[model samples]
Target: MKQVDLGGSGLNASAVALGVMRINGLDSDAAAQQVLETAAGNGINFFDNADVYGDGECEKRFGHALKQSNLQRDHIFVQTKVGIRDHAYDFSKQYLLDAVDHSLQRLGLDYVDSLLLHRPDALIEPEQVADAFNTLQNAGKVRQFGVSNMNPNQVELLQHSVQQKLIVNQLQFGIKHTGPIDAGIHVNMSDPRSVDHDGGIIEYSRLHNMTIQAWSPFQYGFFEGVFIDNPKFKQLNDELQKLADKYHVTKNGIAVAWILRHPANMQVILGSMNQGRIAQMAAGANVQLTHQEWYDVYLAAGNNLP
Candidate 1:
């Protein structure tokens, strides 16, 4: 797998990351271990997790599985998110500090390579967030920080006070869901795609050197379903299959390739817990699609250049 600088943090990370959100669904410890081993063997060194994933069950399972695997702590980068609570978002200093402690205990690690705010808290106080980050960094609990599902303004609001550089912004991006790309292409046009729903977040990340981690790269309509074989995306599936045959990989691989083909250098976080699917998707890191092929797949997904 190809490695890229994770934003401006100076940490090298794999272009593809294994998201452990679904690890809680594994039937056994050995099964989770196999999945982790497969991912590490296939060149995926970055693992994404969240405090609320499976209600923290996934992190516990991944910790146990990592203990059973041969992969060393220094060989990989582990990241998790916080700020999301049962009823509302909480970014208070006490909550942030407590969240990292619990996550470290569950992951069996001294500190996470990175910690992110899962979602924006409308009542967030940037000073409190900065204090929490300072405490975490000084106490050696979190090495870096970032956010998820946040617009550029939200990031800016937090960055104004946080001492640590916010290095990442995780967002939902895929061929079937192309809001970021849409706003860019349809710029200056009187079209629906010209609406900047994200407050120009994609451009902001690129400008500020903040890495955008693309989560749920295969799903459409906010977890409505994967579009690979879904009849609603027949054209997109057909194009993906054609590219898969050309590259001698699975359609899933082609899907991943399309995401990596972008110049943003964003990491594609795969949430699949199945070992076979993990291997198949990782193969996309090796397949470089041509510009025309990439655009073809984009148009096939019901998007217009405008």
Candidate 2:
């Protein structure tokens, strides 16, 4: 697929990323290898992972699969997140340092292309985080840094001290979950869609040139389930099918295309472990939906323009 500048970091990455959160569920290392190879063959060079995914089992599996696939380290960009502990968020300097080392060991790599704070820690000390980042960068353990599930203010709080530019903010975004888009469109309105839940993070990211990585692009209601063929989203599925037929792609491809149609230039993280499904979703990068078609799909997802 298509490559874009990740924020303004000068790092060119695929518009679609293979999220390895669920790779641990695969039946064998060869299966995981196939999934990763299929994605790379389709031009997906970005891989998203987290220290806590499958309790770190996913990262271990991915490392093994990568070794088996014979893919060079420089060919792909690997990113993982930290800061999430067993029950609380920890961004302490020591924790951040240890977390990157653990992730590196698990991934069988010298350093990650990027490291992110999985979630904001309410008791975060920006100075300590900055120190940790400095140590990591100075030691060549992490090339870039970012945050996830954070509002604009929280990003600002950390940016004030961290020397590296926070280049990404991963968020849960899909056709059915359009809080960021809703707040922008419904500006100055008295409707519920006008409520600013993310502290104008969408606008902030755009303004600051931070890439918003859209995670779980097919799921609705926070992992309640995928809405692609669910009866509850009949209207959405019907519209997706109509576009899929027009584009000669599967409904999943249409779902991915709808996310890429946005002007934000955000990366859609695909969490599928199926090799065939991975290829199908990656094809979405080639389908450019018309503006009307994009809006049609959006509205079909139970959202109103207001």
Candidate 3:
């Protein structure tokens, strides 16, 4: 896997990261351990997880499986998210503190490499969040801080008061979830494409040297379904297959390659629990698409350049 500077945090992270959101879906703990080993053997050293995934079963599985694997904790990067509840969001100082402590306990770790606020809390008090971050950092519970599904302005709001530099923003982005790219390419046009749905987050992250970790790199339309191999996206799949043939990788790998081809230097998080599938998709990080090939794949996905 290709290594990129994660949020310019001075940590070299694999461009292709394994997301353990569905790890609990595996039939057994041994299978989960195999998943981690396969990913590590394939050069993926970054892992993404959340408190709410599988209602914490995913983290538990990952932690248990990780202990069973041969890879050591310091050899990989682990990032987890918090703040989302049943019907509300919480980023209060106490909530943030307790949440991270619970996450560490579940993961069986003293500290995580990075911690992220899973979503924007409407009633967030930036100072309280800053205090939580300070406490975590002071106690050696977290090494880095970030946000998820937040617009640039929202990020700035917290950055304004938070002493620690916010270095990452996780978002839903892929060949299908192209809102960030669309808003940039459409520039002054009067189409929906021109609407900045993410408050120019893509550009903002680039300008600020913040890493944008792309989650659900294969899904389309708010988890409607994956577009790869689906009859509804025959043309797109065909294009992907052609590129896959050229690169000697799977069509699924091509989808990941397309996201890696962007100049934004983003990281891709794979949600696959199957070892073979994980290796195939992580292979995409190794193939660099040409400029024309990148746009060709983009256009085939039912998009047009303004």
Backbone clash pairs for candidate 3 read none
Question: Candidate 3, TM-score vs. the true structure?
Answer: 0.99
Model 1: residues with Cα > 4 Å off, grouped in runs: none
Candidate 3 deviant stretches above 4 angstroms: none
Best by TM-score: 3
Pairs with backbone N, CA or C atoms under 3 Å apart (clashes), candidate 2? none
Better of 1 and 3 by TM-score: 3
Model 3 scores worst on lDDT over the 10 consecutive residues at 1-10
Candidate 1 C-alpha lDDT tens digits along 1-306: 888799867899989999999999999989999999999999999999999999999999999999999889999999999999989999998998899999999999999999999999999999999999998999888898999999999999899998889999999998888998899899899888899889888889999999999999999989999998999888888999999999999999998999899988889999999888999999999999999999999999998887
Q: Residues 226-245, candidate 3, lDDT per residue (tens digit)?
A: 99899999999999999999
lDDT of each: 0.92, 0.93, 0.93
TM-scores, all candidates, are 0.98, 0.98, 0.99
Better of 1 and 2 by lDDT: 2
Can you give the lDDT of residue 74 in candidate 1? 91
Per candidate, the number of residue pairs that clash is: 0, 0, 0
